[model samples]
Target: MLSVHTSPLHQPGTGDAGGMNVYMVQLSRALAELGVEVDLFTRCRGEARPRWADLGPGIRLRHLEAGPRAPLPKEDMPALVVPFSLALLKEERRYDLVHSHYWLSGQAGRIAAVGWRVPLVHTAHTLARVKNAALADGDTPEPPSRIRGEHQVVGSADRLIANSGDEARALRELYGADAGRTEIVRPGVDLRTFVPGRGRAAARAALGLPVDAFVPLYAGRIQPLKGPDVMVRAVAELLREAPELRRRTIVPVVGGNSGAGPRGDAWELARELGVSDVLRHFPPVPPAELARWYRAADVLMVPSRSESFGLVALEAQACGTPVLASAVGGLPTAVRDGLTGMLVHGNDPVEYARWLRWFAEHPQAGAVMGRAAVGHARSMSWQTAAARTLDVYRDVLCAERSGPGMNEAGATARSCLADASLLEGREGRNSTLAALLS
Candidate 1:
């Protein structure tokens, strides 16, 4: 598996790491559990990381030097693709297939698969065209080079994975990806860690949240694309309408600055709106800790401009916390309207504020929705996702063994009935360097 830009071992909710990081780590573990030997490759950023580390019983994480030995923005990643690809080709071990996450890795996979004479399966965690269309104000547009790169990857990949049916349709419409070559795989949350333990009161006490406070939690990177400013504005709007509620409401943002943007943008907005006192900020926590934050909240706010899939929403729901998310991308599918959570159309603060008020006004309704959320999240599992992904790998390899002429024809026929999506898992401890790296 080619991760290329970000390491799966990196902590999420900072920099360019988010759901895709979680998706890769969790899915790989699940695949490993199914007896698949996996090698995950990423560019080394000189964080004192080893050249190679064991991720699990069947998974190895390898770091290759590319570009400078430090973090560079995603915009700077295209230049490193050739170097990364060259590094990947140096591997003497043989593999049956190559799978890549995100476009940069997809580009490298395009080269590596050709070198290895293996099939390439690419998952575009977010498409340039899709994100450009839904970009928030002051957010930088995805470069044309990226769009062209995506088009190239889309055309060359032996098979494409989408996090939802919506994403599959986007691939078909935006990049002319063949429907026969596309597969929809829904992402899942880690149910074992994110369950509602000890209910809301204990969670509130553990997190230092007021027991009677109406908490609306934002738990991802604080970037413009995530619409954290919109969340701040909504809180201000909610406070303006009901001054009394301000005393009992707390908006905790558990993330850090990310993407190409200034630092403290959301917090600056909060200060400007005079709602800074109502806001609390915390750096990203581990998944087990994150679940506690979810359990403490009345509703989880996911106001993203464009999300391939909102894994945070599913995680929050798994913690028995209803989500109040923007009705964009896979969020509509993630949060069932009027059931698990409410989906507001557009990024208007007034609408989000209105929903926030409703949840604050009707606590019982929110609790009932939270109860329903747990069941909704339970239906999706990483084991099921891995089983389906293994099917794709087997199918691709099987087609390859049958010869090139029949590969496309066979893959196209079988993909018609495939149903697969995204999955989450536990983060593993880093392993010692292996003899292969030495």
Candidate 2:
């Protein structure tokens, strides 16, 4: 597994907690379960030498030094690719294939693939086009150049692994990637960690939340795109409609700091709206604590304007908590409308308030939904996701060795290019890389 300069396996909560971290950690473990030796290569964030640590018996984390030892934000990552690619090439001879995640990693992966003659596989967790549209005040979207670069990577990669069918459609429409080369692999959740049977009252008591009050929880980054403000308004509306509902509190348990600008403004907005007394905000808690919070919540609200895959929804469902999410991006795929949870229209406070009231009024229906949520969550597991990812790797490797018109080394090289391209872009450069690999 190749990540640009960061690995959730090594530093789980360093930056904005996104789905890619979940994907890397869980998928690598799953691959190991299938008797595959997995080595995750990522940049060292601090002043650390390139070293290897055992994540498990079969899984290892290899830190590579590239560019600065200090941490850089995701936006600044593209500039580090040339150096990272050079460092990656130096170590490329050891691996059979490299699977790259995110565009910056794909850029480095592409260079390394061509330089070292290895197979590259890529997965883009989120697309710039999708994200740019959902940007909030003070949040900067990826520039057009970066988006174009992503197009190149996708077009060039040997195989494109999309987290949802929606992303696949985007790939086809935006990057023109052939349907045959793209694989749909959903991100998985840890069922054991997020089990439904956990005691909500006990969990709430542990967190110092009032056990008698209905707790509405929103977990993840407190960014504008995530629409935490929408949640605040929704809760306010719920309280306004039924003044007695003040007994219930809405908790927005943010997973990461929202920097200095927009996040501060969001706080100000809460105060202005008069829900400051009810809104609870905090830095991301540990995974164990997060699970407890999920279990404790009467309902988990994910009002993100956009999401590649709703991992939070899955986690909440696993804890037998229903979710109220925006019906956009990969959210609808994870959240079954009226089944696991209710799906509301885009960040509309009125619609959200309606759902909140519906959940609050129909306690039996909510309980039924929670039970069904647990059952649905039980069917999807990190282990299953890992196995499927391993299958994708195996398929790429097999195709490299035995597919028509390519020798073992040549096929391997082609696969690597494909993987790298998946990280970079899906257009021109990616197509050129694919043609060269072929």
Candidate whose TM-score is highest:
1
* Candidate 1 lowest-lDDT run of ten: 428-437
Residue ranges of candidate 1 with Cα displaced over 4 Å:
404-438
Q: Which candidate ranks first by lDDT, i.e. highest?
A: 1
Give the Cα lDDT of each candidate: 0.85, 0.75
lDDT of model 1, residue 116: 65
lDDT of 2: 0.75
Candidate 2 residue-wise lDDT, 124-207, digit = tens? 888889888777666678798778778767865667888889889988887787787788887888876788654777887788
lDDT of 1 by residue, 171-259 (tens): 99999998877888888888789899999999999987889998999999988889998999999999999889988999998987785
